[model samples]
Target: MADIDLQIACEAPALPDAAFVERCCSAALDKIGRDGALAVRICEPDEIRQLNRDFRNKDKSTNVLSFPFELPEHIPDELKLELSELGDIVICAAVVADEARAQQKNLNAHWAHMLVHGCLHLCGYDHIDDNEAEQMEALEVQILADLNFANPYETL
Candidate 1:
């Protein structure tokens, strides 16, 4: 199951439908061997920029932001599985579209990449260091390939 709910807070006439987004998220979850739920919100750049500033302190909008589910400290790891919520992914449609055009990537493919990347982030995969980045990118490439998308990190 895709197990993802999509919310559109901005005009999304050009965005992919929920089914496609679910497929991308599902592929990423399956690659990482997890069964959970996620909330994906498509928002305007202004809202995203505010969120980036408030949460990440970046003060700029980005393509995607992942908020992983945080369990209470008292919750046992074994019992935490009962929650099975992967948290949320927020995508800025304008930023993503601009990035796709600037990076010379297929718009849909770039969307898929962002969804997959967000799913991985929800699963605790990050690219903070070179080794971690390589590992994450390799996994992303493999998952995207499984979904028939080309390598996203390669320059066009």
Candidate 2:
């Protein structure tokens, strides 16, 4: 594991809890365990939509996106390089708020969920398949539980 440089910037309508942001980032880095650097940016919907189209060729804003450092898969562990410089996470605050309301959850908890999900992506985790989804969601539940949030997947 190499040193991880984590940078989190929030550019949205309202500022979030500074301590919560730090905790979330720290938890991510802890999970990443110094494999690489990470930059997490919380943005507005329009800004995220533009990024979604520009990078992913998608026209709508999504909750999160992860871009890993350009690297080869066969690299040795010590020589593996810092892929975690992992890239950025663009979250739409309005979308998060709306989702929270729709799901009948605390806004902060939803924010934490998205942040954790994005961080997991930064650390090379994904949910593109069923098995992967289970693993990733399990980890998310454990992490969020540590933060005193309820199991995110529980049915209301």
Candidate 3:
């Protein structure tokens, strides 16, 4: 299996350490059978809000945002083998922490869920429709279960 190269940038002091974030991302990649490079940025609410507004046209901060890298169809096989860039995932530390608290969930568990969710997005999973959401959510539950975490969708 190829290596999962993770580049993490944390702009918030309250966010988890780089090592923990990397482990979470690596687990997600391993579960999905994808080995590639991805960036995970832990930012302040303001930065995430700006990113959400600029890219998604939403003026509020979300827990996470995923930007998948699209490869050209005409790329040579040789070049494709050397290209490992998957995409970027931006997470709002404040929003994640707040949500975890409000939901009465463990912080680490919620963070792992966010990382897994973002990784799935990079791999072309989305929740735009009911069917898509069910599939994605099921995959997430399985992956999290493998990591010894409870289902995120289950109410406490």
Task: Please give each candidate's TM-score.
Answer: 0.95, 0.78, 0.88
Work out candidate 3's RMSD over C-alphas. 2.2
Cα lDDT of all candidates, in order?
0.92, 0.72, 0.84
- Model 1, C-alpha of 33: deviation from truth (Å): 0.3
* Predicted candidate 1 versus true structure: per-residue lDDT over 30-115, tens digit per residue: 88888688999999999999989999999888889999989889998889867889999999999999988899999999999999
Candidates 2 and 3 compared by TM-score, better number: 3
lDDT of 2 at 104: 94
lDDT computed for candidate 2: 0.72
| Candidate 2 regions with alpha-carbon error over 4 angstroms | 1-14, 32-36, 71-84
Say which prediction, candidate 1 or candidate 3, comes out ahead on TM-score.
1
Q: For this target, which candidate reaches the highest lDDT against the unseen true structure?
A: 1
Q: What is the RMSD, in Å, between candidate 1 and the native fold over all Cα?
A: 1.2
| Model 1 spans > 4 angstroms off | 76-78
Taking all chains together, the TM-score of candidate 1 against the true structure is 0.95
